[model samples]
Target: MLREIDVVISTNKDLLGLETLINQIKNQSGKFEVSIIIIHQYRRVENLPKFLVDNKILYKNLAEQNLSNAKNEGIKLSRSKIMTFIDDDVSISQDYFLSSWEFLNRNNCDLMFCRINKMNSNLPLSRNMKDNSKKINYFNSSCCLSSSMWINKKENENLYFDKNIGLGAKFGSGDETDFIFSSLSLKKKIYYNSKVSMYHPEEFIGLDNSKQIYSKFFSYGMGQGALYKKHYNKNKFLCIYLYFLSLIKSVLGIFLYLFFFKLKNVIKYFALFYGKIVGFNNYKNIQ
Candidate 1:
């Protein structure tokens, strides 16, 4: 059974916890053809695996685009029917391709959603995933998998990713969310499978209240809000009203954090809240 799949990863040169991950894939035990496409901007990491540099892989140096654009580059280089999106900060415990092969093949699924857990901690992960068993209308872009995922090679030649909408030059957020929603609008089916799992190592302690971080999140919220309003619900007034309410609630969370824990996260909390207050576009302009 030759399950040919292309693995796509977008990363900077500063990935810290990927040594074990690279080793695991190099030593994977499976009967599958796997190709790795990496979009990287840095040249500091030394001693990359032979599999990555010598053969069975494509390397593109992107010094201009954001993560979403890097992902698009990977998609363009991929020749396999199925494309797997893996983060740079993660590793696999088993044969990464084999774990998801049976499930994806049996279903002949266009989109096979994988499960992810936190690394080095007991804290539960959060997923805004659908609960029902039927094919979902949309999904968060955090960890999405696809077979024939890109729109088209020629007609949608510019379909790598919407640079204007996703994480732009500054590690822009919401690329995954934007992609998922856009795909759903085209009436694509996205399915969830628990068998495929990966570890997402958490590193950010708390979100900074800086203009950059807050603005980025606000743009993310706005993108999410627009999606919700356009597809799920058409109540524009309600969406606007809820948007303001969300801002208030975020601000309130800051005071609560300070009052209870006596922690100095005011800057972080306030930046996030203010982003919501000014709206996503306003936040983007500051960037």
Candidate 2:
């Protein structure tokens, strides 16, 4: 008896959010069976919520704290044809599961990236294309956010997130992009759909916490840079184009923000620009 979808959530120290997401998943209205796989990292089993035991939702405790590793563990434990990865802090629409199933089978998609809107706001959490669905390629793969992504394991049995470039890893980002690039390299069918959406909290960038904000953005930039280097051999033109595009954007953002006396924005863009350079140079060293 195979399940229709296995929703894998890699979480740590967010029991409240985890419990809320689980309840939301339970309330999801769909004809298919959906199983939840929780990869709890850096936490003791005793710290987990009691609902997990009472409800008998499958979960595993991992001592390691790598995002990619946690997600890979979920993949290993999953027993479904379709797997969906989402962050614990986010919430999905009521039609998320059914919509994903219908879209995948209707379009014969191997992997699909859905829109991520900010909770209670019309704006999106990240840059997304128009509402229309379209094929995803290496050039516009920035929209392939992992939190709202669904994958067909039967079509991509060998696909796995890169361990060296995620949140807890040295590079600290770009795990999703690396996964998308690998799928494209294998000629997998990938699509982006706005109809299948999830809601995430807005990323806060306050004036009082400029240093922390800069550090976070810099880490993300490093991962982006490493990602470009890692896949340079696979698609030279795409890599070069994206690398220079980021460089140019960061530079422009710095000058633009500086002119308007937006010190926070200036710091963010500068850190990102410098971090990318360091990451590109230090990729081989880290490996």
Candidate 3:
């Protein structure tokens, strides 16, 4: 039986980390035949790894399109039983593929995810690991979704990454999470393997009580709100009302922090509230 797999890395020019990840894959043990697909806007480095260029790695350049389109292009080139997606910034643990393969093969899930380990030691544990035993409830295609996953090749025609959702790596987000939700709604299994992990390097030793980290997370939260409004099936009127209420609460939370607490926390909550409002208002524009 052929146990070949194709891994697609969505990258820009993070060669410092990319080289390490490539080596990890090359060194992993399995009867798997591997191929690489890189979707990049521009190659910042002149010389890529010789092994990657000399072997089966295929590079597709779409100078101004969104990442969803790039991901779609990579999937088109993938020729194997299983297709995996990983981010450029991640360093996979040795057992990453082994765990992914076993879970995918055993459970027959097309959309699967693994745990993430934040490189920054100061971040809380919830951001890094999922309780291994709990069943995954929804699809969230961000670092974790792309860090490790398998999609059946034959199913490609039916599943194209929505270019509209993850467009341009901008304020737009949640395409992968939305995709997983779409797949699971069709009754396909989506699995979470807590043991499969990757290391995400952030700027700080851990996200200290920094203004920058809070701002980033606030943008992330707003993106999620946009996603829920776009794809969730709950009552529309209620959803809109609740979204507004939540947005207001986040704003008030910031004010409270301003009055009697950490200044960084206030900025974080303000950014999050702003992002949610912006995201929510922009949905009409996206369509």
Candidate 4:
């Protein structure tokens, strides 16, 4: 009766509301065993509340500030066949685990996908992710955030989180997407199970008409640039096409805003397009 799934959550100093999130996971009505682990992203462990230590919850306090690095460490510590990542700012429904476990057991795929509810918004991040039972490799359609990803340990042992690309690293974001793309490139099967889900708080990504949004988009570009550098000559057309297409998409959105005399996101889109072009060239020497 060993646990088959490990839900790895990464958090920093902001640990005020984890009790409710942990309660949600504890209440999941799943047949298979699930171990919820929290990795304190900061170097110091003394600040943690006593309840975490007294409850004997499986937790770790590492000095590493990298998000992917902490997750990779979770893989090393997890004693399960499946590893799923969630953020500190998320909660899950009762059926989240059971559905994911059932889907993985039935399909036996290397990767599993579930629904993501923006605990703050009515419309989902993407509408294509239906409640249908199916398998697909959609590169640009879905993001790794809302739909928390599940990884089969046996199939992805050689894959490690790209440390230089996640939060607190060179690129302030794009770590999860990098991990997903890396898994896909390994020829592994990814299954999308629309039933399972988790709740991400209102500001999961801080995406909006704010100045901070530019930094968010910039981090993505830098990370994407590093990815492009890694596979510059590998996918030639497909890779470059995606880069150009992303740039064009943002640039077009900026124009649409200007036409309407609404200048709220003009700088934001420009920053995104600029980040893509800059990210494409910035990491060429490193990877």
Q: Pick the candidate with the highest TM-score.
A: 2
The C-alpha stretches of model 3 lying farther than 4 A from their native spots are 14-17, 43-47, 120-128, 138-144, 154-156, 167-170, 203-219, 232-266
By TM-score, is 1 or 2 better? 2
Cα lDDT tens digits for candidate 1, 96-179 = 567666666666555566665567543424343223223444323433433213222223333346564454533234455556
What TM-score, to 2 decimals, does candidate 3 have? Answer: 0.79
Model 4: weakest 10-residue lDDT segment is: 138-147
Rank order by lDDT, top first?
2, 4, 3, 1
Per-model TM values vs. the true structure: 0.70, 0.92, 0.79, 0.85
Please provide, for model 4 over 1-287, each residue's C-alpha lDDT reduced to its tens digit, 9 standing for 90 to 100.
55567878888865665777777776778565767788887757755555455343688888878888888888788777877887777677788777777788788777776767677554454555565656655354343452387887665355777888877777655666666677777877777776666666543255665667777767766776666555657677767767777778788979987888756567657766777777778776556
Question: Could you tally the backbone clashes for each prediction?
Answer: 3, 0, 3, 1
lDDT of 4 at 225: 61
lDDT of 1 at 44: 49
Residue-level lDDT for 94 in candidate 4? 80
Q: Candidate 1 — which pairs collide? A: 141-176, 167-172, 209-268
Off by over 4 Å in 2: 1-3, 54-56, 205-208, 259-262
Q: Which should have the higher lDDT, number 2 or number 4?
A: 2
Question: lDDT (CA) for every model shown?
Answer: 0.55, 0.82, 0.67, 0.69
